[model samples]
Target: MLKRVLLLLLSLMLITTLLVGCGGGTTEPETPEETPEATQPEAEETAAIKMAMVTDVGGVNDQSFNQSAWEGHQKARNELGVEVNYVESNQDADYLPNLEQLYDAGYDLIWGIGFMMGDVILEAAEQNPDQKYAIIDNAYGDTPSNLVGVLFKAEEASFLVGYIAGKMTETGKVGFVGGMDFPVIHGFHYGFMAGVKHANPDVEVLVQYAGDFNDAAIGKAIAIQMYQSGADIVFHAAGGTGDGVIEAAREQGKYAIGVDRDQNDLAPDNVITSAMKRVDNAIFNIAEELKAGNFPGGGTVVYGLEDGGVGIAPTSDKHVPADILEETRAIEQQIIRGEIFVPDNEADYNANY
Candidate 1:
């Protein structure tokens, strides 16, 4: 009887050990199930929407509009979880090919950085009707359903800087150096001239066009001539060429108003203000719209002082007088409230003035 009791106890102990081993096997399988949950978010991130841009002739780092636009896409990547990239265009010939490269890569949205690319973007949009595209500084009478056009009230911003130039000039004159003589650039000229007139009609505005946006040497030469001729301040609407304008200001102890981006960093003491276009804001907004399924394709979207799309650099306070900033803000509100119409063209300028 004692032997039978000992054998029964040993059998019971063996059954308990087997049960614990079986439970451990079940938990091991559960770890793999939890692994997929840990990696699921990574999979979603890997499938994120891709966005890209093709730079204009000035390339991506022109320290101008192209750089601003690229910054916009980069901001989208950081805040919106979209992948972004850019391709440099050495000349007009590279526009279509560079765009095609991004397009072929299956980018969900592609951008052409300047008005010079209006035709190229249009061509790409027409060729790939299913693809979506956006262009800065250009608007078309007719465009395909997949394209978006972006325009800024450049004149409004130009007017603000022009007012600053007019008020700050001690030499009784200011200057304007432009990249091209097209209507887009004309907006800058007309509005600036208007603002100078508004502030001091007797203050002369010396105007010149570099005819090329890439040559900093020519821009510097033009600005130097204007300064030598008794102009104390200069404003530039040129692209990379505008860098020369700021350089001349720094070297000549004069002030320069920059364009497209906040160029105060180029020459902190020399660049008093800039006609801020908010291209980065525009591009980021478009990306947000796309992510929200509300993209404004096949149409034009205009940005201006009213919508905070265009304005002067925040750094103006360091170089601009408190009274001038106060007055400029007042004029900004006037434009926003429709009490003032900043002209953007030759006829409108003449009519308004």
Candidate 2:
């Protein structure tokens, strides 16, 4: 009986050992499974950075300043894996609020599209020193260290377009229509007039302002009047209002110069050339710098003919004369070499004229 009891005790001990070994084998697979979940939290932490832009009154699809800037923002988002958004300011009052909304949303970069936003951007930049911002076509007098101002030498390209208009005009009279009376628009006027004078000093250029960037009717009326007054070519620096100028040129069988983009397509037969402003390149460069952790702050960045920021559009299938094209190219080279100074202020325009 004692032998039998000892044997029973040994069998019980063997069963207990087998149970412990099975439990240990099952826990080893669970340990490897938990290791992958530990790595998943790190993957979730790597998210994209956010960038935003606030458009001027003309909105994003103006096919002008707003459109170009938006394209640049998209380029950065795609190439750098950034998240992007844009707010359109239909009224001037929306400028500050739009920028503020973007900042509050934790966007790293907020771009203000035009010079009209200069005052609003200045005030906002001062209030939010921690946020980085960029303003195009204008610079504030007292910009903060976190803000960057992009200014363009638009006159250089306008001058080239003016030369084309001067030589192409069947009538000795030409015209210039501006969106508003800002210095930026004035730069276009001054440069164009200079180019016209350079080509034909005796030619008369009729200048008019639409007084509003968004008013197409005013643009049409001014363009029609210019066309009726024996003007064969009308160069318009107006935004959406410039659309009216293109329409008038097409309807009247007259030539028109488009601004900001390659507007030749707006009226292929009627458009001579557009004074191109590389707003896309400017915004792209700024975004790239911001991504690289190097933001240009507290100073104005001027992009001119030498920097590929401004130039005349390619002559279309309608064809400008070879001699005229040659002359404009020569002037472009001179402008780049600093031999020609296209004025930006009213004083220079008055002095040169």
Candidate 3:
């Protein structure tokens, strides 16, 4: 009877254990199965640097200085993996606002595309001491620590084209159209005059200033008048206004020389050659230097024939004779070797001539 009682008590304990295992008590959620930590994604790459430019009144499509500079910025973006952009200035009044727009966006570097913006760029640099700035065609007497001046020997390039004009003119009379009476224009005019005289002392060069760089009509009118007056070739340093000069040449069946860029495409048959001021190279090199952590600021970088900064366009071979091109190259070497000194101003031009 005691053994039976013991068996019955053991069976009752087993039944209670079975009931507890089946779900008679609260669940503890299985400790959430020891969940693993979440994985993270990789970080993205950023641009090496950011650069922006404020174009002059000529705008980026001027097919001249502004256009060339924009090309440089594009090349920097493509080749160096840098961020690049530009804002056009429709008029002189737009320069400040355009620069301010780029400044507010916090660009690593800012560029003023013309000498006309010298005063304003300098003022902006002084106001924002930490920001970097650069300008083309202008240099300050005392540069700020954050500013760089990129100057080209326009006279050198102008002289080469002027020599072409003098040598190629069938009427023995070539013409010059200037944007303004400013020093930069003076460089173009005086250098051209010197080159013309150097090439052919007897060839007459008529001069006119549109007093505007954006007026194609004014340039066309001036060029037409000059063409009618017996000039067979015309060279212009009048920015976008030079486009009209080339147009007039096409219409009148005369020759035109472009400035700041290779403008042969503008009037393939009419445009004989161009004066190339390597604004694109200047801009690209500066961006490259900045990317390499060697920003050259607080100084002026002068680009000349020796450094391949300024010269006649490569398309000269298409129109100019091989002998002429050879002679031009010889003269180029003379200038580079310091055997020939091209005058850039009125007084020097007059004194030397």
Candidate 4:
């Protein structure tokens, strides 16, 4: 009886041990199912570029240099995805402040339009060495390494227009009206006179300066005086003031030549043609270069006939003769090919005269 009892106890202990081992092997706390590490997305990057322009005293919509420069900045904004802005300078004193405001606002490129802003641009560029800048029409001495100076051989186009004036004149007299007394403005006068002489050596040119760019009344009065004095064609380089010259030509039934931009459409019947300086093209090219990371610096860039920087406007379908158009094109080709030289400076003018 004692042996049977011991055997029963041994069997019970073996059964319990087997149960514990099976549970441990099959169902141990599932090593807390390791979860995938959480991931984060990378940030996107954006382009950083800005441009600004300071207009001349005549303002941004002056239908001349200021307007052209503004158009260039607008182009940069549209094509390059850049931020752009502009400030119109009402007086000479406003130039530096306007440029400084743009620079302080973190603009990468700043442009000053017109020769009248030459000194202002120089001063601003010197003070703001970290900023890139550009000036049109004149370079004030040696520009800083961050500044670009743009000038055009406007005399080439003026000479062509003057030739047309000389050929079309019924009277032996022609005239020139300048916006200011600056050497830059005088270049137009000098070239026009030379062209007239080239076409008709006996023709006389009466020259006058309006001293202001926006005074259309003064321009009209001056133009009328010239017309009454037996001048058949009067060429004007007087900015907004030149509008008066066209008006005078229309009133007097005489011919007028426009400048800077094509004014033939202003009075298609009276404006024979315009001496185009390609100011818009210059601004556009400069802005494009800046966008391409090739900003011109520390030097003056002079664009001429070969670069399409200067040319005569298309002959008026309303008034310009086909023969005159053909002859003008022939002369233009000669000038571009170095077969003809148009004078700009006073010394050159005197020598040619």
Tens digits of per-residue lDDT for model 3 on 1-353? 99999999999999999999998888676665766778767687666798999999899999999999999999999999879999999888999988889999989999999999999999999999999999999998999989999999999988888888888888999999999889988888988988888899999999999999999999999999999999999999999899899999999999999999999999999999998999999999999999888889989999999898899998889999898889899999988888878999988998898
Model 3, residue 308: what's the lDDT?
87
**What does the lDDT read for residue 24 in candidate 1?**
44
For 152-260, candidate 2 gives per-residue lDDT tens digits of 9999899889888888887899999999998899999999998888889888999999999988788889999999999999999999899899999999999899999
State which candidate, 2 or 3, has the greater TM-score: 3
- Across 1-353, the per-residue lDDT of candidate 1 in tens digits comes to 99999999999999989998778445545334344444443434346778999998898899999999999999999999999999999989999999989988999999999999999899999999999999999999987789999999999999999999989999998999999989889999999999998989999999999999999999999999999999999999999999898999999999899999999999999999999999999999999999988979989999999898999999999999999999999999998999988898889988978
lDDT of each: 0.93, 0.88, 0.92, 0.85
Query: Whose TM-score is higher: candidate 1's or candidate 2's?
Result: 1
In model 3, the clashing pairs are none
> Native-vs-model 3 lDDT?
0.92
> Candidate 4: lDDT of 308?
90
Cα error, candidate 1, residue 310 (Å) = 0.5
Q: Cα RMSD for candidate 2?
A: 6.6
Q: Which residue pairs in candidate 1 have backbone atoms (N, alpha carbon, C) closer than 3 angstroms, thus clashing?
A: none
Find the 10 residues in a row with the least total lDDT in model 1.
Answer: 30-39
> Against the true structure, what is every candidate's RMSD?
7.8, 6.6, 5.5, 4.0
- Judge candidate 1 against the unseen true structure and give its global Cα lDDT, from 0 to 1: 0.93
Q: For residues 206-244, write the lDDT of model 4, one tens digit per residue.
A: 999999998899999999999999998999998888889
